[model samples]
Target chain A: MTDPLLSVRNLRVTFATRQGEFQAVRGVGFDLGRERLGVVGESGSGKSMTGRAILGLVRPPGRVTADRMELEGQSILNLSERKMRRIRGSRISMVMQDPKFSLNPVMTIGDQIIEAYRLHAGGAKGQARQKALDMLAAVQIREPERVMAAYPHEMSGGMGQRIMIAMMLAPDPEILIADEPTSALDVSVRTEVLNILDRLVRDRGMGLIFISHDLNLVAQFCDRVLIMYAGRIVETLSARTLHEARHPYTQGLLNSLPRLDAPVDRLPVLPRQDSWRDGGPVGESLETDLPGGL
Target chain B: MLSLALTLLGLLLVTFIIGRVMPIDPVLKVVGDRASQAQYEAAYQAMGLDKPLVVQFFGYIGDVLTGNFGRSISTGQLVIDDIRHVFPATLELATLGTLIGVSIGVPLGVIAAARRGGIIDQVARVVALVGYSMPIFWLGLMGLLVFYGILGWVGGPGRQGIIFDGMVPSVTGLILVDSLIAGDWAAFRDAFSHIILPASLLGYFSLAYISRMTRSFMLEQLGAEYITTARVKGLSEGAVIWRHAFRNISIPLVTVIALSFGSLLEGSVLTEIIFSWPGLGQYITKSLLAGDMSAVLGGTIVVGVCFIALNLLSDLLYRVLDPRSK
Candidate 1:
């Protein structure tokens, strides 16, 4: 890629707990072009924290630092809150994990989408409403006008997630960071949501940071995958070669999943190794190709 | 609607049972201990005490439904008339107090939540603690001493100053409003001055509760994932706090505010006594002391109805404010 949409090097997120300083994301680095870049890790492995840190959403006592965190060649890390807010929805936006808790229960779907669009776009109410309806239709919601007047509780989980996608993409952001967007959905609905997201990203030629713990799903959906282990990127490989990963942690994760073709009596538990925490990092240095850098 | 009617009926039944079962006798209260057997018998029959309890209850319910609450032995006026005259005084005071409380409390709470663990939060906590724990009568008395007794900054005692009493026509039974209608600026000033101190004291008490609730509600909402979404949507912090979080809390906050208002209306007995304000609290207390069961039961019933009405109002508001309820 001529110049990646987002570039980060040595990003770290720290939280001050009663026991001591705890590092959530340590020395994590990546580059995002107009492609689906997947960050795969188990719970507490810092994939979610990385997404929040990039959006400047981390609350107090949780500090984020990066040697170089830029969005399209501009340093975005640690910008003033007012300035950071400008870049948030318009330049780069985030979709939370679950739509059930992600949409305001009181607001109408139209009002929420309109509000989100107006916050960044700042146009007339009619224009915002028009834009909201268009966005809803873009996400393939039937009866956009009727759905707009309905509340979050009235919609199913799949519809709610689609509404969320519509709202997040309404501002036309350069990059969309979706944090486990389809985890709360059913298997059938999950594929539909991913398809909508995939189509939008490709249509807009926007960079996407897809965060998930489903390794196989990431391999099938993402162009590139960053395997995280204990707050650091242990491996970076093209999604096609994810199963053939050399890292012991990645291999352990893959082995833990029960495969249908190879019917096993008992699925193997991942026996974690101590070296995964602070071992020599497996990926190449910052200066490398955007994808398939390994 | 049926539940509402049933709830009120149950409330009236409980009050009626309590009145009848109490040691004080209604016939004795009217005929007195020295009355002859004939007078006592006549009074008992007139009071419907001689009839079956079931019959008496139905009679009382009929009387209440038709707006006849009987006559007050203490005030020598009809029970309905007495309530009509005095309830508004308490209504005016409580409304003003609640207005003061909600206006100040909500913003204080939002600020405290936004700056949690900061100086403003600490101040709000202390204020709520003091207002919640402090005795209202003592607060009223102190208010009288500093503002009325010492500084003479406000009118002392009663709903209006002696000079302005009965000067304005009883249009709405609210002196402040009546004075305004009469174009009696002097009376309005006197009524306003007299009401301010007591209203402020009640307002302070309510503010404590409102602010505490608002803060907790805001904190919970602030932590919600939707709030994160709002922030990520590039909304100004003010918009996120006031428009999104505050709007969500308004549902529960309505209940808090309505309950506080209702309590202030019926439960301002201490403030009324300290200030010698001839409101419902004072009216009920005076009648209760004189063993005037007619007046006492009537006042109690009115307060209960008002409480129920306030609850109904809040429920209606819940439907208006929360989409899920609808």
Candidate 2:
């Protein structure tokens, strides 16, 4: 098989708190190819942290230490800010959780998209502008011209997210790291956004890291799934086989889902014992001594 | 725009009421204490103090509309004429002060905010603290002593040197412009020498205010998501800070700068006194003390109008800078 698009190993993110050094992401790692990979976890599970670490977007005081982190063939961990900037929006781009906070409110949508494109493409104003309008149309904005001239506040949540996708994709990055990109949108538009992502990846063969907490959505949308718990990945399986995941954490997560057909009196809760914390790699077995009752 | 108009109208009404509520009699202020009863009655009648309060208020408004602000009992000149002479000088000083303040303050603020917790930030914080806390009158005096008395580096006092008394024409009433127009470099130098120290002193006061506000504004913007987005867009750190963050922060800075300019025009009274610059602050203060009601009221109105205009200008700037406001 050809080399993966990106690889990470032994990644640890820790914050120095007053109490002590609190490790947020501990020894979590993965490899990504030109396929849709979803990272599913609850909030505080460090799934977003892993996504951010890939782009060096993790802010100070929250340290990222990794044994190995590479993109294509380059060691991204130590690249200078200048070199990293060129790679960021060009070779790899990100769509944040909410467009309300992600987009610059003062600027027009068209100008921002043009900026994203021209920063990497180095084209003239008219060309860049035309390209930006084309991107707006690709994102299925009905009135691309009016949307381009509009401000972020003037647009709806779904429209804003679409504009964000357009801007991030305008740079034509090889890998798109979407960090819960549609969690802020209404349920009605979620499928439309997913369709856009699906078409982009299928047509362009661009690799995707879809980070979200929605297990069912990840199962349906992504090619493979990584189920994380306590800042560690406990299971890695193809999306088709996610319902049959081996780890107790994954089993507990699946059990908690509200099934439309089988409505139980009380949803089964995970019998979270102390030993469950020490489960090593993906699909690793429980401790030798299981004094458990679930 | 409607808010601004309402604000100006409200200001005029408030100041008018304040003047009327004063316990001091306008007749006593105009006529001598030992003046005859008839003379006192004549002065009262001439002031229209004999009329009802509402009638007098409307009468005052009519006179104001017709450009009659009464006569300054002390100077014996029309109040409008005094404003025409003094307001231009005050405006020139304020404009210069604003220029100096903005030039020095904004860069310092950006540097301090960008390098937060570093040596530059520490030094700037201490310097800004001292500037804000230090009395302007004291700073003005010390500046005068060093720049004037000891060093003999600038003109001592007044608007221009006594030597340039009749050299430059007063076409614009602003000495610097008038001198340049008259093609008198000597007069220009004298005016520059006289103006620089006072302007810088006022500038120093404004700089402290403007820089402190700018620092907070920039600090907030630096943490905003757009700044990170700019950085992620392959823009350099300088571009992120100046072009992106600075633009976002400048909306609030406009208001601070404009308010400071208005106060400067109302007169850096202490600086004016130290430099003896004949601006509106000194004019109004002297008029009030001498009980030249016309001059005092007229000066008050002029300063009020200036504040309103500056506020309106800043509001428009905010709309232009942040399209979200529009």
Candidate 3:
């Protein structure tokens, strides 16, 4: 079989602190083809760090080391910052969680997107602007001209995210990392953003890494799911098999999420365990103690 | 815009009224206390200080409109001519001071923010601290001793005295201007040598403020989400910083620079005393001590105008840098 679009192996990230070094991500491995891969974990579980590390955004004092990190058979770990920059938007892009702070406040949306396109394309200004308008329309923004002239703060959250999505997709990268992209939007706007992203991924045949803590959303949207806990992946399963997860942590997360079909009087809670290190077999007592079977 | 205009007009009116109401008896003060009452009354009438306060204010305003500021009691010269001779020197000094301050401060701030917590960043922080702690007067004295007295690499004792034997008065009150007018390369070199120590001493205080403000502004911008977004776009570190981060941080940095420019224009009295540069700082200090009312009032009005003009310029810059403001 051909190699996946992106592959990571033994990825380790450590941060130097006054209290000594602490590993944020320990021996994590994953691969992405032209498919939606969901990474679900609680806050501080190194999920976001994994995304930032892959993009080479980790700063000094926080070190990222891996035995193997490649994109389409190109060794990403050894690339110089300048070369990596060339690959960033053109080959890989990211959608930040919040549109409010993600967009540059001082610049008009059109100007910013046009600049983003020009940075990679080396095209003339007018051509870049036309391309930006086209991308805006692709993101389902009606009256792209009117929205282009508006500053980021002038647009609503949903509109701003659409503009952000438009900018990110302008370069047509092969891999798109969406870091909780819809988390900050209202419920109604959240589905719209997800749909836009889904359409872009499907049409472009790009690899999508959806980072979030919501299990239900990930199950519905992603093709494959990785359940992370305490900075390590505990289980990997097909999205269709999420309800039949073998790991207790994954099952616990599933149980914690409320379902619309069967409203419970009181939702079942996960049994507390003291030494629950990830990437280990589920304990017998914890498995047998589950309130319900898959 | 209307409010700004009205505010400026009100400030001018208040200055005029306050200028007339102060009861120092300018004639007696300038002519000394031993003068008889008749002599004092005659001197007051001659100087037009004997008129009622409101009348004097209107007369002053009318005279100003007619391109006159009356006469100086100490020198018996036209007030405008004296100001013309002195103000240029002050402006040149202030401009040099601000330029030096910004050139040094901004880069230092950028480096500090970029290498935050590193050795270079630590040193910058320490240097800014020292600059802030050292008083302008003490710093001026120290600068003169080190750069002029001991090093002997610069001029000493007199204004523009380091390289040139004596003053070469030219069309411009500023030495650099005069040298350029004279087309004398040697004089230009001499003037620059003399200006270096004094201008740097004056700039140190402003540099401290600008560096601190720039550092904080840069820190805030570095934390901004767009910076992260820019990084993800694959822009190089330098482009991410100078292009994206620098432009955003300029809003606060511009305000700090403008305010510092206003302070520089008011003059660094200690630096003026140390170098004996005939700028407004020295002029105002001498006039105030000698009770030269017209000169002191002229200096005050100039400083006040500097503040108002600087504020207006900063507001305009705010609009330009942030389109959202409009």
Candidate 4:
């Protein structure tokens, strides 16, 4: 394609701990176009770290180093904090995993959303507030006015996530990173949040990085999927080919998931092999021998 | 709201009764060994001590309502007048001390939390530790020696600083107010200089508690998901910490500060003693030593009132800051 909107090359994030320098993301690299890309991995697999590194939000004691980290063809690694701030909400935005702790507990939903809009828009309070209301409506929130005035604690988890989505979209960022955005919501509300996000990404033609551990959901929604294990991306493939993933870790994860249509007497467990360490031949066979119940 | 008021009223009544019935006979203690049993009984009867405890409590409450706290046993001065003279000084000291505490403590706390584990944070932690560990009396003595003796930058003993050097004491209380009323700049400067040492000593104690509370509060807020969201939204580190994190953490800090304010008003007794600042703590100390029943009772009531009032204020502030309290 004509130069992806964002490109990350040889990205590594290391956290200094009592044990030693533990690498959380090892040589992870990806490019994002104006489409949905999903990074699926279990907790501590470094999917969240990758998102944070891209946004330059990694704090002290946790270091991020990349040979090439660029956004819209411009290198973002060396940008000054002031310049980085100008790009943060305007060009790139992130929605967190839980809305309960993500949203300011004391501030009204409307004030917070308007503040987010005005951070980049530099408009009057009235205009910013109007934009916030419009964003709430865009997120399919009914009675936007009432919801805007509500505090974070007053709203349900689903409603809070919707509000968070509205706020993130208010700045009209070119790229949006949603880290387990619907994981905290009920199963019934999960699809609703995902649909809202999907519709918004398509309408705006924005690049989206959806981070989750649910392969089925990612397969259905994302164009491309990256499977990660132990801070390393073991496989990259088109979502349509996720059922035929070639990485042992990805295959193991898929086998672990309960299947609805399968009528086997007992669910098959994927074989664990020591050679699967560091993505080797035993790992390679694990990906291919999936149907045989090996 | 009515229930809250009733609860407060009940607490005040209980405190008053306890103050009265505390085993030590106020009349005998005041009159001393010269008085006979009959004389002691007569004095106690006049003071309404022979009446039933409930009857005596109601009488005291009624007298308090009417602004009659009886005459001081030591000086025979009206208790109300003693309070009027001393309360202003105590309030001025408390206000200045709290201002110093909050202004210094909040910034120190925010910076320490922002840095997390740097040299500045380490230094702040050390200072907070020292402040908490040092007794008010010891700190007061050390402050006097350093600021007044070694430095010699301030006034000498019995001079009461640069203020009131030549100015007329128009108000007889509140040196700053009297100085201002007389339009005496030199007196004002002197009065302020005298105020600094005592205010700082008290402020240091308050600062210790407030900064510790604030640091923990900010640390919790910094780890919050919204802070991450703020950073992702392109806001600078300063904006995320100060604008978003600071506002969220203020409710708890405010409560700590209000409670500290109440403590300051009760007076940092040692600080007042060292500087000879005639505030309520010094008054109460002297009254207790001399067995001055009226003055002691009056001081207790005033201090009690201030403590209760500050708590109420903190509750109101809590509601204002977090609308979820509504």
**True contact recovery of candidate 3:** 0.70
DockQ of each: 0.87, 0.56, 0.63, 0.72
Q: What CAPRI-style quality would you assign to candidate 4?
A: medium
Instruction: Estimate, for each residue in A1-294, the C-alpha lDDT of model 3 and write its tens digit.
Output: 346789887788899999999989887777788999999999988899999899888877889999889999888984778888988888989999999999988778888898778889877999999999999999899899999898898888998888998998898899999999999999899999899999998999999999999888999999988777877777777889788887888888888778799889898888846555644633222223223421
Q: What TM-score does each model's chain B reach against the true chain B?
A: 0.97, 0.94, 0.88, 0.90
Candidate 4 per-residue C-alpha lDDT over A178-284 given as tens digits, one digit per residue, 9 for 90 to 100: 99988889999999999999999899999999999888899999998888777777788778878887667778888887877875567667675555447632123
List lDDT for all candidates, in order.
Answer: 0.91, 0.84, 0.82, 0.83
lDDT by residue (tens digit), candidate 3, B241-324: 888889888887888999888888887777777777777888778877766777777777767767888889999999999877
lDDT of 3 at A150: 86
Best by TM-score: 1
Q: What is candidate 3's CAPRI-style docking category based on DockQ?
A: medium
TM-score of each: 0.97, 0.94, 0.87, 0.91
Could you tell me which residue pairs clash in candidate 2?
none
Poorly placed runs, candidate 1 (over 4 Å)? A283-285, A290-294
True contacts kept of each: 0.84, 0.54, 0.70, 0.86
Looking at model 1 chain B, which ten-residue stretch has the lowest summed lDDT? B23-32
Clashes of each: 0, 0, 1, 6
Best by DockQ: 1
Candidate order by DockQ, highest to lowest? 1, 4, 3, 2
Could you tell me which residue pairs clash in candidate 1?
A: none
